[model samples]
Target chain A: MLTIHNLQKIYNGTTVVNLTELTITAGESVGLVGNNGAGKTTLFRMILDLIRPSKGEVLSKGTNVMQSGDWKNYTGSYLDEGFLIDYLTTEEYFKFIGDLHGLSGGDVVERLAPFTDLFNGEILNQRKYIRDYSKGNQKKIGIAAAALSNPELLILDEPFANLDPSSQIRLKNLLKKFREEKQMTMLISSHDLSHVIDVCERIVILEKGQVVQDMQTTENTLQELETYFTV
Target chain B: MLLTLLSHQWKAKLRSSIFQKSLVLNIILGLLILYFGSIFLLLGFGLHKILGNMYPGQDVVGIFNSALLFCFLIDLFFRFLMQELPVLAVQPYLHLPIAKNKLVHYVLVKSVPSIFNLFPLLVFVPFMYTSVMPAYGAAVAIVWVATLLLVTLLNNYLLMYFKRQMSTKPLYTLAFGVAIVGLMLLDYFGVLQLKAISETLFGAVLVNPWLAVVPLVLLAGTYLLNFYYLKAHTYPEELELRKTNTATGGDIAFLNRFGELGKLIELELKLIWRHKRTRSIAMMSVMFLFYGFLFYGKGKFMDGFGTLIFVGIILSGMPMFNYGQFLPGWQSGHFDGLLTQKNISPYQFYTAKYWMMVPVTVLAFILTLPYGFFGYKIILINAATLLYNVGVNVFVIFFFSVYNKERLDLSKGATFNWQGVGASKFVMMLPAMALPILIYLPFGLTGIPYAGIAALGGLGFLGIIFRKQLLQWSANRFVAHKYKLAAGYRQS
Candidate 1:
């Protein structure tokens, strides 16, 4: 459903991202691996239309995402904390997003029904202003909101870092369940190759803003990815 | 090292547009303050004109002494309140194989060139030179001015030492705010009996110029005591936890009162309270009030100027003053989550903001009401002005919220204004000024008190009638300006 062709970005007169062509079919779970500042975020921004690329276009379902009203509805992202409004409680935060996606409160609760215990009264009526929340708690609330929209595309940046191991596993399972139920497309980026290796159908390694390798996760596994990372 | 510190101070001063503007404006403004100050001296001139010659106590030295005490109080207050104690410069030397006391002394020395020290001299010297110089001769005027400076400096040094001790205590922010406000109120209401005190002090200074040295002993005593406190209580943890707990008192109170809005307001309040810069609402208000005093008290004017002063004093402190100036950037970190999920309308967002501004406007009114003793009808005008402040001014500017966008980093020094305040304040002042004129002009010309009352009611009713439309317009305007405001706050 997502497509990128010759997506080039330049900063300070030097190219940071120059993705010649890339596409993921609807519902496909694709993983992007990259060096730090390898233009993964720039790519993500292109996909979200947060920043402009110097050339080329990113399209979702044959429509250019940068120009499409449908893109905001179909896509969910957690890449920028500046995108977060600290004045809101987690509950109000979730409610605002769901409303934007035209989801009813009941639908939101039904969606959240499974994760109540995991959140552990830690987030309920957790009226603590998000500004006062710990980084991990903010991460928990952000991840929870992303899944609440039940969108066709979900993109996460370093989603596993602040999360506890158990919650990370739970997120993996939730992503799995969503993929099976809705055939949702996921673009996930992370430093922990092992975490994505088990979940992604295909892996693409990005080094310095260009794809160095693209292969099936079945072929690389965590060990091969580890070897690639170390080398 | 001293030169480096002074140059750093100058660099910091030069970098600020406000400081630069003030220096330029003050040259013009200084002449005005001095020229107007001469009028007070001309009260003695008027006395000279009236009683055939210079009568004892015929001049406005009473005003000068009153103003001098004002200078004294300001220096003392800043010495207590400002945390720019130059501890950072010496932070590099803390590891230098130097004794802590020597390091502390260096920090203390660095504080003398502060903006606080400059203000008194700017104020007193001009008045002394213009008023007393020709009358008493330049040498006597110079002595009088220096005597006043030493008095202010001695108080400043003592307060600095006092702050050294209090920084060790709990609830220092709250205590500092309370003490300053209390002291200011005492001075403001003239309960300090300033007119008599000044005459006595000037009489003393005239006889024995060396008597000014008595305050120096007190200054030295305070400095030594404070130096000892800093030396003995140099540990970090002594004052840390108290401030942390002190911040929570407002949080709980706000949460209890505001309900959900209270929760949001509490977040906003805590943001301001935590960041000394955001808490500068009081400072901004006082500045507005102080500005009004300069224009109002500088002249003995009729009702319209009084109305302007009254409104100026009250409305200048709109709670939303700088808080909502940045619109949504105050929510920078968590906005994504709020944007992504749940369901909040633009109305709810703007509603919370309107509610927050209410108390500040109310407090501003209460503060201005005392000027009624100057004239009771002026009090009525101020009360009418309060309604106009709310209905015409406060509401109109709520819609203007997008323009003057400055995201205050609460942690930044109140003086550190990197956040670029856009042209909204300049634009907003037009409607705030114009609407009041329109509302009052017809009634004002008639001199019918009821007409003024009717004008106020009519304006408020109009605001209430159109509040929904204004809010809708505000929401749309804010949404449009979101990205611009957001980028600006982050940049600042």
Candidate 2:
């Protein structure tokens, strides 16, 4: 459903992302794995049209993402804290996101019902702003907000980084359920290998902005990814 | 250790993004300092002669001494408003090997060199040289000048202590402000003879320089108070001026009727209400509603359409100008989120801002409608400018909105925070303020000033009628520049 053609992002003569071509099919769950400075977030930013590619363009559903905003209609993305409006309460923020998607207040609560386990009772009815929440709680809020609309395609960067272990497992199961039930296309980037492998059907290992390996997940995929990631 | 800490502060100032990003702003700031510095120096050298002319055949020294009390009082009030507490700079060092006492002293002494404390020296020292040194002997002149400096520092430490107490015991700060205003009012109504008291007190000081000890002792007491306070609460959270607020404001239920546009406006209003900087801008806008009193009744400004038009524009447009200059930057934190959101078109985005600013401009105009009581002419001029503000100037702000790219930290106070201010802000003000007056100038010169006022209002009426096209034009501009803006904000 998304395609990148010769995508490149250059900062001060050094290329941060340089992809000749990459494409994701509909209802495909793909995991992006990279180390620090691998330009994983930069690639996601380009696909989301938050950053203009230095070369070529990103096409969503056969239309250039930059030339038209139609991709945003079916795309929900959370890359960092920048995606979350910190001043709003979690409920207010969810209601806002819900409103954007024409969801009523009750509709918002219904949509957020799936995240109750992931929320761990720390997120809702806290009567605190998102800024006052802990880092892990904030991540949960961001992830849930990204999923609030049940968009056709969802993009998240480092979704498991700040989450607690149990919440991370819950998020993995949540992603699996969304893919199984709604046929949602997800593009998730993570540092945790096993969690991503468990969540995504396919894994793309990125090294310094280039895809060094792309393979379908199997029982041995985790061992292969661990071997490739090892020094 | 103190020197090292001071050096770090100096480096921090030099390397801050706001300071290093814009050389034009730096030059403007430098020229402003020079401009004000020279003006104060000239005023200092000329004060004795001016006072002599006002109170002829009187002891100019005694006159100056009497006014010093009032000057210090006004200075304290201004310091309370403008001065920032220097608590955060010590946070990094708190866990270091440095002693808490040394850090506390650094925080207090660091405030000693601020513009509030040092700028007055430009006037005071020059006055001492021209007036006091010659009138009194060198020893007495030195004592008088030293006493003034002591009081200035006394105000500095006193402000630090009281301002720190502001969060915990706000009543102290309020009581302090009330007492100062009360003293001024009592002096104004002639219930208290502050001038006579001040004259006698400083006269006694000039006769015996030992009387300076009073201010010195008071300064010491406030300093020790600050020192002990800082020593006990060196933790960053306690030293913070504002605690993390419990989320206070709720959704404005009425806003739900407008759909997404309403959501955007509601979000922006909550943004303004929740943040320290934006809230201060709102408060400052309200304060500026009284700004017409400075020029409305004055004969010099009343007769001229030009000056009145300028005043009217400022009266109605201050809030818009103050807040609008930082347009999308206020959302810079979530700008990427905004860009990637569903169905949030550029046109709708600017439309939300347009509708948001229009009512505020109109509300400001209505609030300042009392200025019309000065004259029907004042009403005519204000009504014209109000139209111009809501119609033309709002578009002018939108026209320049795309250039704002810096991220704003909403948590800080707006007083001296220059985080997102750029040269474009100053540039944007030029057309918004000057264009209406320029529109009026030709007709005024042609001896048809009322037509000029009408013409200004006429242009605004036309702008309002064609606002859809103007908004479209603004959105097109935003679309053209969105990529560059997104890139810039991401850097910070």
Candidate 3:
């Protein structure tokens, strides 16, 4: 569960993220849809406590996210290349993340078996560093690493952007499975309307750092998102 | 088209965000260049007199000729180390309508303006103009100067060609280095007469101006080779293939015993070995471990314990000062992930970093232990500095690390790199180096050097005993600056 109260992020006199109040209960699947400067990442950064907000707070499980470390315990986020240690091998990266989460090497080895479908056989035993991987492959590695610890809360920004069609469908199915099986709370942001509509049970539309729409996913949610962005 | 390409490069340099930020570094580098230029000019103009005074009635021109070849060889070695290929600069133009040959030509020609090319001229041209021109007729002097310049240019392009080749296959670098050393040894022991060869080559140029064609042909040959090499590899895929190979995985499995701390240390070691900046520092620090021999062998610190302790601490703590000054900035690439992870404790992170330095410092101290053969005093002083380094200096490094708000790109080479540097880094070095000396100065000056060494060591031992408290203090400081550091890392 996460709560945002009068959260505002100002950069050079412009409000990058301004949310008056919002909350998401545990096990809720939320997709954040925004345009180019829509403050999607800014809001996520506030939640992750990567950056300090100029006004109000983001609370996780009744505790202010900025003031406490409790949220980090259950949160796993992959926003961009910053989430990866680019110098490490993909396998090493996973193992390092697993070790950080108190998972043993054998446990990590066992866990990576599931990601073989997502990896598409290009990532493992590739003998290449994550830096040298193609952008799409790098994204797969980041996404897989984000899910390494199986945290309660997962956040991904534009996860489907660089992925090919096959990987995108695989990721969607993966998300659906995780949500159904473990009730994992997810906050995914994407420019792609169809992908967001497919995975999220609820969608929140952000425009110019303000939440414009908060509604349950419907049969016509994709059509509604497409119509809104027609211009 | 080349002019347009060059103009873009000029704009890129001027418009770089780093350019404005590094204005002070640029100015300092400019002054350093100016200073080196003046020294070379002085050496050039004074070469005639200095050689005359040394050789006394021998032909100075012959000596200069013999020495010129050695100078060019040394210059070639330096260029091999420092010269970066301009191939990457031409990447943006690859898909453009420009011809591949023209692009390659542009890249090769761009290297002419380098400081390496300009430096030798300052040293060589003056000596030739003032001495050789008047000694020989104008025609021979002109030919000699042209030959020297051509040889310099030849070395530049030849080294570039080899460097490009070696980037893909490093065996060539080793073979060339070995061959050069072998040749130098052969010449040194009087087996091969390089002096005779140099005298004959230049003497022939003076006899017949047309003999300058030798160096001219060599320069042109080297240029064409580089030009063709770049032309063949201009495709993005080919360039990428040449730039990087599949990374061979490394194992630091022994670290698993230490649990999370060991894992962090393993990651840090891998990062250091894998990245250019950190790799260079790591290699250079290991090389500097032998620095104690400079003091011990030369008996430079025989007069007092003060200077001895200074060298001892520096020798032991070299890696800490070099590597620790960056801290979280070195992890800027992945700082967000590191901070967001729940399982990582800041105290443990600090402890892991502090403990990593212990091995390196201990390694350097172990290497320097043979200095005890010189004197018991030297060994005692070094032991004290070693303790000071392990206990006090490492904590200082960690404490000052809290102020590192700049982000560093680990992949860039350390030479002339000013990335992620701030006032905090400069100030950090002061207490790191000064604290040991200040601790040693009191009893050292009062004729109680043993007590000073023991006191410094005792304080360091105390710090070691209470390391948990020290690490907690450092972790608290890190937490205070955590957001500021993250903000800076984001900007970078």
Error of 2 at B176 (Å): 1.5
For residue B142, give model 1's deviation from the true position in Å: 6.5
Better of 2 and 3 by lDDT: 2
Q: For residues A31-56, what per-residue lDDT tens digits would candidate 1 score against the true structure? A: 88877988888788777765667889
Query: Model 2, DockQ value?
Result: 0.01
Residue A211 lDDT, candidate 3, scale 0-100: 96
lDDT per residue as tens, model 2, B1-492: 688667657756876768888898899899989999999999889998999999999988899889888988999989888888897776534322245678889998888888888888888888889888898888988888888899999999988888889999999989988999999999999999889988988888899899999889999999999998887776555788998688989999998999999999999999999999999999999999999999989999987889899999999999999999999888888899999999799999999999899899899988988888899998888899988888899899999999998888888899988888889989999999988888988899999999999998998999999999999999999999999899888765
The local distance difference test score of model 2 is 0.87
Ten residues in sequence with the least summed lDDT for candidate 3 chain A: A65-74
Best first by lDDT, ranked: 2, 3, 1
**lDDT winner among the candidates?**
2
DockQ each candidate and list the results.
0.01, 0.01, 0.02
Over the stretch B1-492, how does candidate 1's per-residue lDDT look in tens digits? 445435434554454444343344536545766776665455444532443344455565545564456556665666665635543343222211234566556656666665566555655666666567767777777778778766766776666655644555536545765876786687669787655666678656755767766766766776676667655543333312224333344436635675666666666666656655666754665666544454343344644543553454245345445554555655654554545445455665676666667667767767766665556655565666665655556566666766644444544555535444444555665665666666556666777645866677567667656777877777787778767766645433
Candidate 1: list runs displaced more than 4 Å: A1-231, B15-89, B96-102, B122-148, B169-221, B226-228, B231-242, B250-263, B269-317, B320-342, B358-392, B412-423, B442-456
List pairs with backbone clashes in candidate 3.
Answer: none
Question: TM-score of every model?
Answer: 0.51, 0.69, 0.67
The 10-residue segment of model 2 chain A with minimum total lDDT is: A80-89
The best candidate by TM-score is 2
